[model samples]
Target: MLLHILARGRIARSPEGELLDRYLKRVTWAVKHTELPDRGGNIPPLPAQARTVLLDERGKQFSSEEFAAMLGRWRDDGVREARFVIGAADGHGDVARGEADVLIAFGAMTWPHLMARAMLAEQLWRATAILSGHPYHRAG
Candidate 1:
């Protein structure tokens, strides 16, 4: 399955962007990153088997192992793209949240969008590594 991150805000040539690139490069699965302006950019078309996951403050928090399992399940079920949406500073609207297949949260604390992007990228790498029997993720 393709792991796609469709996020709001330009990451630019910043540390977060570098971190995102480094982790994403280590991921064995197909990965794509799409950045939109803080507002007004249309989300791209999704595949028929696409699964949308929105990152929100009220979203469910999953352990690294569990997150990997979720991706594994989607891959096994023939999902073509697992699209993770990270909204603007104001966060996602009700419409987006309602339409998402899953709403995920890193924690209760709010993070800058750029930092969140980097964190999400690292988590994606960890999840894929866990799925591929890699020792990078040492789960407790």
Candidate 2:
């Protein structure tokens, strides 16, 4: 399955962007990264057989193993793409949240959008690695 990240705002040449790139590079699965303007911008239409995951403060927090399991299930079920949406500074609205297949949160604490993108990238790598029985993720 394709792992796509659709995040608001340009990461530019910041350290966060480098970090995000580093982790994404380690992912064996197909990956895509798209950036939208912080404000108004067109969001690409979702492809058929794709699942949308919205990163929101009120979303559920999953363990690394659980997340890997979910992704494996989706891949096994023939999901073509798993798109993860990260909203702007204010986050996503109710309508978008309602349309999402899943809502996930890093934690209750707020994180900068750039950092969130980097964090998400790392998690994606970790999840994929876990799924492949890689030793990178050490779970108790």
Candidate 3:
């Protein structure tokens, strides 16, 4: 399945952007990244067989193995695209959260949008690697 990140705000050329780029390069799966303005922007149409995952503070936290398994299950079930949405600075509204197929959290601590994007990139890489039978030394 395709792994897509639909996040708010431009990462620009900052350190976080560089980190995100580094991890994204390591991911072997089909991947796409979309950046929108902090305020208003029209989201692209979802692909057929799409699953939307919202990154929110109140969401469930999953282990790396669990995340990999979830993606694997979706792929095995013929999901075409797994879109992960990262909200703006103030975070997502209730409507968005309610509409999501899944809600995930990085941790309890608050992180800057740019950093969160980078972290998400790394996690995606790790999850895909684990799913492909690669050894993850620090896996939880």
Candidate 4:
């Protein structure tokens, strides 16, 4: 399955962007990164087998193993793509959250959207690695 990140705001040339790129490079699965303006922009059309995961403050926090398992399950179930959405400054609205197939949180603490975007990329790489039985992910 493809791993796609549809986030708001341009990452630009920065440490966070570099970090995101570094992790993303390690993932074996197909992936994509889409950045939209902070305010308004058109979202890409979702494929029929797509799964939408919204990154929200109120979203559920899962362990690395659990996340990997979820991805594995989706792939096994023939999910073509898993699109992860990171919202703007004010975060995702009620409607968007309600429509998401899954809601995930990095932590309870608030983080800048750009930072969150990078972190999400790293986590996706980690999850995929874990699913492939890589030693990179050391469960606590």
lDDT by residue for model 1 (1-140), tens: 99999999899899999999999999999999999989898899888998999999999999999899999999999999999999988999999899999999999999988998899999999999999899998877
For 1-140, candidate 4 gives per-residue lDDT tens digits of 89999989899999999988998888899999999998889999999998999999999999988898999999999999999999999999999999999999999999988899889889998999898888988888
- Pairs clashing within candidate 4: none
> Any residue pairs clashing in model 2, and if so which?
none
lDDT of 2 by residue, 1-140 (tens): 99999999999999999999999999999999999999999999888999999999999999999899999999999999999999999999999999999999999999999999999999999999999989999999
lDDT (C-alpha, whole model) for all candidates? 0.93, 0.96, 0.92, 0.92
Q: Evaluate model 1: give its lDDT.
A: 0.93
Off by over 4 Å in 3: none
The residue ranges of model 4 lying beyond 4 angstroms of the native Cα positions read: none
RMSD of each: 0.7, 0.6, 1.0, 0.7
TM-score-better candidate, 2 vs 3: 2
Question: Cα lDDT for residue 115, model 4?
Answer: 90
**Per-residue alpha-carbon lDDT of model 3 for 30-102, expressed as tens digits?**
9999999999999999988999999999999999889989999999999999999999989999999989999
Better of 2 and 4 by lDDT: 2
